[model samples]
Target: MRDSLSLWFIVKNYRIRSVFIKNFFIILSLILLPVTGFSVGIYQLYSKTVTEEISSAHLHSLSRIRDMIDMTIREADNYSIRIASSETLATLMSPSPMHNYDLNVNVLKMSAELNMMDTMRNFVESVYVYSEQNRSVISSQMGRWDLEQFLDQGWLDSYNTNKSQRKAWTVARKAKTFQSESEEKTLITLFRLAPLLETSKLGSVIINIDTARFMNMINQTGSDYIDSVFIIGGDGTILGSNDLTLINRPISDVIPVKDIAEGKPNEPVFVYEDESKQSVSYVHSLYNDWKFVSIAPLKLYEDKAKYIRNYLYISSLFSIVVALIISLVVSWRMYMPIKQIMSVVSRPGEWLEESPPPKRVNEIKYITSSILDSYGEKRELENELRYRLSLLDRAYAIALQSQINPHFLYNTLETINWQAIRLSGGENVVSDMISSLSQLLRFSLEGEDNLVPIRVEIEHCKHYIDIQKIRYPRKVDVQWHLDEKIMNYKIPRITLQPLIENSIYHGIRPMSQEGMITISGQLEGDSIVIRVADNGVGADPDKIERINQELADKNWITANNHIGIRNVNQRIKLTFGDQYGLHMASVPGHGTTVTVRISAIQA
Candidate 1:
């Protein structure tokens, strides 16, 4: 009893069934999107929050680092100012002849100034005064060290900047003087240009700070999340790095310099994410073309939000699952009527695939009735189209038969020509005329096929022109420039004969002078071109254009006589393709040239 009741409910009228299911689904969908979308939206919001936090934190830490870097550079600049202003150091470095006592006095004066400068700054490992005048190296600690041991000639050229008087930075190099073999010390040099005093040379001052100390000062300002820190010098090389191993490496080696150059300058921080490494960056421009770039792992900040996302996801999953189950139950109930309708639609000629029939409703009956009516109308239309097409085929056959029938006309012509040949008593003109006439009739009545070999087609045209020759004698002449090699190519039967006829009646007959027709053939790559041009009374340019337009456009309004040219054009195109057709070219008082183009298909 319960099974019967359930069946009855399912097989209820379609209008009521569709309305109930549609409203139910509408309510169900309204419930599902918000719940699912809210969960996803919440997750995205949290993700954005996490990204912003990392970026904010990155900029903040770099700001601190920037402050520290600025302080160090300012202090170094102050040191440079002091060194530049030293009168005793300047006088000692200036060019002069130095005897033993004079050299000693000058050396002592330079040493005292360096010692004072050294006491004022703690970061400087040593300050060297390279003098061009005396060609000597002077330092704060050692009065004189071998110039080669402390500073190479290469260092002079390597660190030379275009501009002078400003402090310049260099990539880390092996500390020249103070280093133990157990731990190699790398130094980043800061060079201060010694000012010119009375056009005397004071050379320059070089300050070397151990790279470990220089990088430490920059790294210490950043937060614990920072994965790597770099100090890139103006020369595009890494000057100092927290990872001592990366010192002296070009900025291009870590990140593409092109990417850096094109980066948004106004962006507080730049984030680079890839499979190999993910990090947020902060770039702070320092004085003298130095950039402090810090890359901190993005995963660190992302991990901070992971637990929150996971907990929220777990909570939302249960609600989605419950809603999904409810949706499935409602959707399954809605699918029955839709499935039945689709079964009929997917197959065009067939209707139902069921063995035991399902119950039908008034809506189903109406739909089936409408579909049957449409199907019946389509069948009737198809039958009518077939009937009309059959009539068209018969009409074409009758028309073709009228042109070249093997019965009454062709047979009678052949009989008369044979009689004339027999009775001519070896008269060449009568025999030749009968021979051409009989051959032309036979060629015409040969078969129903449209295409014929080029030789056969040419012979047919020659035959037709021969008959015209008998009528007019030397009034018209045909100049054949056909290439014997391409003479075997197949073209539409009767193709050339009609074109020659048009030239004669329309062109040659209208002119006062003797008419000449030129027919030529050549292999033009993949196509055959046959020209039937006449030296007849030329046509008006505008009339020629109108005729060409009509021939070009099949649907153009045209007179009955234009049909021959238009038919030839359409036939060639239909036989070969649209690319091959007839073209008419003419000039006033010159002539008209009608060229037939078709595929060069040799038999």
Candidate 2:
């Protein structure tokens, strides 16, 4: 009888059933919507971050590779210079009593030296010198051959035709060289004409450098993420590469070599594919007019990204299932009680009121109460968490600013040292001055808050300017018009240091004659006014006005003078008030004056 009544009660309870269905759908949507959105957002952000990091890493690797190539080229140039100045080479080319002195002995000696050079340096595959005057060829490896027959008979003729106008030329061609049995031996030769004694002299010296070593150096410096390196010459030839099959191949058969040769130097280009069916490539041209390409598979990082995406999707599905299960449990618990009440009411009015006291399970009662309490607590906790996250964001910004400030100061000091050496100052004096200034500046930068007493700030600025004066003794004139009364007032540390650096770098360094910078500080009514004025090629009024506007609007976020000025201005206003900030005035060809105003803070 009770089971039948319960079934009837359950069928009659439409409100309870509707609530269960509604909550189930609501819970399902809630679980799915945010999870989907969050997963998408996270995936996009991760992808972007990964792409940027990879791009930066690739660029850094390319830069290092370029440096290595430049270094190697410089070494080759040095060798050429040494050889060109040799009396043996001169005598062989001139063939005169003042110079000749037995060509056969000198040839043997030159051959021995070249052999030793090749033995000592793995990169020097062979060394050959061609004398158009004598129509002779001398090589360390092949010995003297008919200059014409060594390469194609027409090769020397072509080289001679272009030798007068072209200072140096590099071409990729097959060369006979010893190789290991296991190694596929395809060689590309780099040939450069040593500077001739006379501009119009027909005789030229050619050095054949090992293309393998050059490619190896580039490959070592390139990012491991890159699959291969290709060295392409201005002429349509693949000079060197890790892939032996491409050696001495025409550029037209491999990639867009003609387009690159005609393109602007150092301009980076992306090639989606090439005829060789290699990976996607990013190409950069060297200063010597050679092309460097870094190639990597397009799908290298794609699988990882896809894996992450799949994991996120699976996690979202799992979360939704869990949410749905919890919703069903809660719905059943709530509806069960309503069903019991309805059953009693349907039985009899008396039973409905009296049986309301039917003992509910303690566990169920506790769960019902906890759910209501948890709903409110969860909302409150979320709000608190968001507030804390906002605070953390601000703290992160402050941390970034703190870290960047010291690094900038340190790099600027290093730049000053280099400039001092360039300006011909004694190394010992410059080192000592830099050491002392570094100690003082480090203290200032690593000290407490941004605010320091005016006296301390002035000392820091003075030490910096003193280092500059040592480098440019009679060239710089610095005038300090500081009022003693304001020395006790607090100001920002290293605030004036950048201004002094700018005065030296952008102002004094450019002028051939004398340059001057004037620094003055005084107290005006409850405010401290500090001015740094430079008498060099000053700022344009339009630029100054634009910077001022940007500072006032607080639009400067990038690292530059305008940004620094804007930041200092904004920080001052934030710490004090809008009235205390920066005011800039300049006249082109006259000078520039930067004035910083801050409320006087007692030491």
Candidate 3:
């Protein structure tokens, strides 16, 4: 018994230790995959990936911030438009009060007019209506008053200055005492003229949004990656910011906005820096003529990735520890079965060699009884594997057959193409059709791979367009706006053919006179967007919207009608992620534009 125990410890214990060490090494190697791929020798490539991801995240957050700002500005503009267009406000703001006896009625009417802005639920610090003719201010806090005491000289100079546009966006400042300290809050004011039919000078309306409240809204909407948010003018005049010190200061030329006015409106300007340096991203608001700048240290941009990396490291460590324990357990379990066989081997040789009945004990019986039918069982497994391979091969062959059938058409077309060359010197109509048909077929069924170069897809489209132009030679004209730089980027095969086909069939052919189909490609942000537009009788707005909805959902129930477009949309999504796909914008009488969105990436 002591001998058996000693042997068990010596043999089984060593096996457990050996297996544990081997498995731990394997697991540690596997845990280091992310590190080897990006963390170690490929540090520069990993940095670029991290930077792009961070920039994209910042851009997305900036979009949301822009939306919130646009919405806020729109609400203010709407309020001004509403007040300007109102007949009641026009009557109240006239050169003279309309009624002298109806003082109470006028008060009630003005009070009710003031209360209209309250219902909007926006963060309005105060509302004021100032009459420039009389130099009088009618505020929500203080009713109608004919005085210049409400505003300081500096405040009045900025407001009356010709700097801001029709919608004057004033920097937040502590104006002189108007009504009370209760009404005072460091505020940015928006000024709009009360709309009138005649050229008679009336007053302007002032809507103030608290600087703190505005910045709070900005902070809440902005992602953690945005370290600072700024609302500045074209000349770098700081209109608003979370930091009060930055609020009135001139923007440093280091973060330039001088050429922002020259830049096309709505385009974002981005500046990036190293890990220790600050990065700045800004967008110009066409409505208010103010640019919003979001600045952050580069490390903040990678903070989320840093957290994820740390988490992965901790998880790998924990997994390696757990794998060590599991390997020991598994090694011990395996040894039990082997130990039973070893016992049989050590027993009397003649009895062991006998073909014996199974023992009742599970470990001994399980080890001994399975050996007799091992060859038959191996044969059965081999047959099952063969059956599976046969089915897979047949399925693969059927798929190849489907793709191969298109080649038969290509072969016949090639023969006709050669015959056309013999008949008409390869320049006649049939020759063109055969050549186009062959190219189209090859493009459509070239290989199992879905992606092809943009140049190839463009050529495929041009070939299809050539066939269409021949069918209606007098009416159709094609213009190419291919960007040479993006031609090598891979797009799903035959992507533009369906779009061009739709433009020809549904769009151009429907129009009466000569129609033009324009195909354009350009880099819009990080995406390579290709647009197909036709000056044809466009589809009804309702139908266009329905088609767009269907494309978005990829719910192609009827394969017969929109199969080509459906396939293109699905292929675009499959090749690039779900965020990239087809979009449609159309005008009822003018034309329809189909947009194909693909991520611009190297093959």
Who wins the TM-score comparison? Answer: 1
Put down candidate 1 lDDT per residue, 156-274, tens digits, no spaces.
66445422534444446765554344555677776666653434335777676767776666666568757677777767678778777877888778765354444653244444566
Higher-TM-score candidate of 1 and 2? 1
lDDT of each: 0.69, 0.67, 0.69
Ranking by TM-score: 1, 2, 3
The segments of candidate 2 whose C-alpha lies over 4 angstroms from its true place after superposition are 1-23, 95-101, 112-120, 148-158, 177-185, 217-223, 235-237, 248-287, 297-314, 329-603
TM-score of each: 0.48, 0.46, 0.40
Candidate 3 has its poorest 10 consecutive residues by lDDT at 554-563
What is the per-residue lDDT of model 3 for residues 1-603, given as tens digits with 9 covering 90 to 100? 235534455456675464434554555566556544544434456656766766667767776787788778788778866765566566666666456656446545665676587534456766766666656666666676665566533356666674335444555575534544555456677766664453553766677777778888789878877888888765666778887656667766446544444554333345555435455667767466677777756675467557766766676677667656665566556555665555544442333456576646485576555543453465578897797577556545655666666888899899988988898765688888888888888877767777878887777878888888888978889999888889898898877888888888888887778899898898888899989999888888888888788778733333343337766886677568779889888887789999999999866
Q: Candidate 2 residues 388-480, lDDT tens each?
A: 577557655765777776678777877887788778855778666976676665865576687888888878877877777887888888899
Error of 1 at 395 (Å): 67
